[model samples]
Target: MESSSAAQSVVETWSAEATSLAGAFRVVARHHPDDIAVKDEENVLGYRELDDLSDRIAARLRARGAVDGQLVGVVIDRSVSTPAALLGVLKAGCAYVPLDPAYPESRLRHAVGDCALEIVVGDPKTVDQCGLGALRVVDPGAGHDGGAPPAGEIEADASAYVIYTSGSTGLPKGCVVSHGNVLALLRHTLPLFDVGPADRWTLFHSACFDFSVWELWGALLTGATAVCVPAETARAPEEFLDLLERERVTVLSQVPSAFRALCRMAGAAAPDLSLRYVVFGGESLDLDLVGEFVRHTAPRPPVMVNMYGITETTVHSTIRFLTGQDLDGKGTAPVGRPLPHVVISLRDRDMRPVPAGEAGEMYIAGEGVAKGYLNRPELTAERFLTLDTDDGPRRFYRTGDLGRETESGELEYLGRNDQQVKVRGFRIEPGEIETALRDHPTVRDAAVIAHDSAQGATLLACVVLRDGEPGRPAEAALRRHLATRLPAHMVPRRFAFLDDLPLTLSGKLDRNALLGLAGAGRNGRP
Candidate 1:
C-alpha cells in the first residue's frame, strides 16, 4: 500500500509539472502579447504572433496527415519560423526532430530515415530536400494552435523531442528526450539564469546543436525574447559581435573557439553592447580565453558559465559559474554540481560507486536522463543502464566520460576511459595532452590523438593558429608549452599546423578524421 501510494504521488507531481510548463506559454502570450518572442536576421515575432503562428502551423501539419506521436522533422537555420515549427509539432502531440540546413543531403537523409520522419516543416527547398510526405510547416496567424487543441496530459516518459547525434562510426542517431526531462531542466535553468519575459537572447548556436535546446526553450517557454544570430553572422565573430550590440542581446552561448575569435574581434574593434549572460559548451572551457574576455570587456563581467553534457542528456548535465575569485588558483573551473532532478555520480567499471576525488566513469541519473537512442534499443540498453541504488530502479546514463567527484561536489572531467592509451603498459588519455597544447598562445584549436610509430608508440598534436599569427609556432615551442603544463609522457611527440580543424556535422572535432589524416601523413602503430 505504501509503494502504491508513493507511485501515485510521483505520477501526480510529474503530471502537474508538465502541464505547468505548457500553461505558462499561454499566460506569457496573453500577458505580453506584443513583446518580441523571437528574432532572426530575417524576422522578429511577437509572443502573440508566435502563439497564433504555431497554432496555424500545427493545424496545417495536421491537415498534412501529421498525427499524435508522429515524428516530424524541421529543416531550417536559426530563424523565427524555427520556433514556430517547434511549437506546432508539440501542440500536435508529436515529437520534433531538428535538422541542420547546412548538412549534406546524405546526412540529412540518414537522420530522416533513422527517425522514420513522416512530415517535414520548413521552407520549400528543405521540404523537398527532406523528401518527407509534406512540403512545409503551415504558418498560422497570431492567437491560434490548430483549434485550441486540448493540451494533453503528458506522462514523465513521453517523448518530448529527438536530437540527432553525429555518430562516430555510421549514420547519426537520434536521442529521445521526454517532456519531464525538458521541464525539469527549464525549471532549474530559467531561475538559475534569471531569464523572464523581457529578456532578449542572441541565438548564436546552430539549431541542430544541442545547445540550441537551451537557447530556444529556455526563452520561449518562459516568454523571454530569443534573437537569432544569422549563420553568416555567427560564422564570422567580428560580424556577430556587431549585430549582437545592435540587437541588445542579453544572453549568448558559444564554443571556446568562437569565444576566442570574439575576444580577438574585441581587441581589434570593440562593439557597444549590454549583455548579462555569456554561456559556453560543446568543448572544454579555456580559462586563458576567459581571462582574455575579462581583460577586454571589464566592469560588469557577463556571467560566464561552462556547461557540460552531450545530446543524450537533453541539453546540459553540469554547469560551473566562473567568478572573479574562482579564477585565482585554477586555469579552468570545474564542471559544477548537477541541477535539481539530476544526480551525477562517479562509478567504477562494475558500476559501484567510487569515493570522491577518485577518477571513475561518470553516470548521470534523474529527470534529465533521456529515453535512450531512438530505434537503437540494444545500444540504449548498453549505455543507459539501471542502477540498483537505494533510490530504487533509477536509470543512470553511462556518460562514457571519466570524471572524479571533487570534495566540493563538483565533477572534474578526466577524459574518456576507452580512449585511454596503453603505451608500454602506461594508460594515457590524449585529452591531457590536447589541453596542454591549447595553452600555447598562438594555438587557437588543438587535437591530440594516439598513433603507432616505427618507434613503438606516440601521440601527435594538430593545431590551428590564430589569424595574423607568425609562421606556425615551432613544434619545439609547442613541446616546451606542453612540458610546462603537463607531465613529460603526456606531451605529444609531433605537432602539425592545420589551417582549419575538421569538424563533425555536429560541430565537434572529428577525432576519427584526425586519426585518419595522421595515419596517412605518418606511420603510427594502432
Candidate 2:
C-alpha cells in the first residue's frame, strides 16, 4: 500500500458528493426536466416523467413493506420501465437485485429465495413463472395516488445494488456494492468520456451484468439520454449497428467479442457512425481485431478505449486510450493505467510485489472496491485483503487475473491464472494461441481451450472463418501454420470449426461450454 504520487493525489482530490442513487439522480432530473432521460424503440420518457414514475413506484414499494437496507428484486426487461423500477427501488431505500426475465425459472428462484426477497417490481407474468407467488409483485407501470412520501435519504455505505456472478463451485454469489462505490466510478469515468446532457448511451448488456450498472447510472446521473437496445437486436451485430445509428448514440460500450463481430459484419468499410467513444470490456481485447476495425473505419472513427474491470471492483478499474501504434505492435492490447482513486499491485504467490515486467496476480484497492459477497463471509474473507501501507490501512480485492506492469506504469494483461495450461510439460497461455489463430488470413474469430480427459490434456482450437472463404481449414494446415510461430506442444492437437463461439450472458467466452463441446466429460475426463 505504499502510496504513489498519482494514487495519493486521487485520494486527496476526489470525494463523492452524492450520498444515494436517488439523491444524485434527482439533481439531474431537476436540472433538465424537459430532456429525454430514457428511451426505447417505441417510447420515450423525459426526465420529469421518469422521476415521477419512479416516485410513484417507490410509494407502492413502501406500502408493501420495503424499507431501508432491504433487498428488492427488479425483474424487468431492457425497456424504459426498467430504469424506472431500478430508480424506484433506490428511492424506497432498498438495494435493487436485477432478476432477468429471460433467465431460467430455477436460477430466478434461487436468486429470490437466497436473498429472502419479499417484493419484486416487474412484469407480473414473469413473477408468476418464477414461482414467487408468496412475494408481492408491483408492476413498474402501475398507477399510484399523489400521497407518495419524500424519497428517503440513505448513507453512503448502504448497499445500492446486488449483482450475482457465477461462482467456480456451481452456485452464484452476489456482490454487494454501495452507492459510494458507484458514485466514485461514475465520477471518475464520466469526466474521461466527457459525458453530458447531449450524449446518448445505449444499454447493450443484460440488466444482471455489472456493465449495465455503469451504462444505466452513468447516463441517468449525468442528465444524458439512455437508450435501451432490444433483446433480439442486441444479439445481432448488424441490427445493433442500425440501432446505434438510428438512435444517434454517442457513447457506446461493448464486449470485445461482440465488437469483433460488428467489424466482421461491416467488412472493410466502416459505416458512418456518430460515436465519439467506444469502450471494450468484459473480456480480453484482441489487437488483431482492433487493427481490423481501424482499417475499415475512416481516418478517425471513434476513440477506442480498452478497460479492465471486475464485478468485485464495481465496473471498471483501468482505462487505456488505444492508438494506431497499439494496433500496429502488440500481443494483446494493454488494459491501461488505473483509474483515479484506484491502486493496482502485481504481487507474486508469496504476497510480495513482483518486479517490473513479471507476471503476478493483480490486486485492486481504493474507492471502487465493493463491500463483499452478500452471504458468503468465508469467500469474502478469502478474496478481500487488508494491508497496511505508508498512507494507511488499505483494502484490496484479489482479481485472480495475472498481469504485469509496463515501463510507463500501465498494466499488460496476461491470461487468467487458472487458464494457464501445461501441455507436454510446457506451460502455455491459450490467449497466445488464440492470438496466433487470429493472425491467419482466413480466420475471423478464434478460441483456444485446453481439455483434460482419459486421453490426457490436449489443446483444442475452435474458429470461425471469414465470409466468402472456402471450407474450414484442415487440421494439418492449421497445425502447420501454428508451428511456424508456436512450439510443437503449444500447437492445438485438434481443431473444431464453428460458426461462432458460445458466449456467457456477459458476452465473455464461455469456457465451460467449450469444454463440453470438446467432448470432455462433466468431470473433465473423456
Which pairs of residues collide in model 2?
Answer: none
Q: Which candidate tops TM-score?
A: 2
Clashes of each: 7, 0
* Per-residue alpha-carbon lDDT of candidate 1 for residues 307-374, written as tens digits (9 for 90 to 100): 88877777888878887776554355577878766888789988899876899898888778888999
Residue 144 error, candidate 2, Å = 0.7
In model 2, how many backbone clashes occur?
Answer: 0
Per-residue lDDT of model 2, residues 305-369, tens digit only: 89999999999999998988998874679999999868988899977888888899999999999
Error of 2 at 20 (Å): 1.4
All models: lDDT?
A: 0.73, 0.83
Candidate 1: C-alpha lDDT: 0.73
The deviation in Å at residue 295 for candidate 1 is 1.6
Candidate 1 global TM-score = 0.88
Q: Candidate 2: lDDT over CA atoms?
A: 0.83
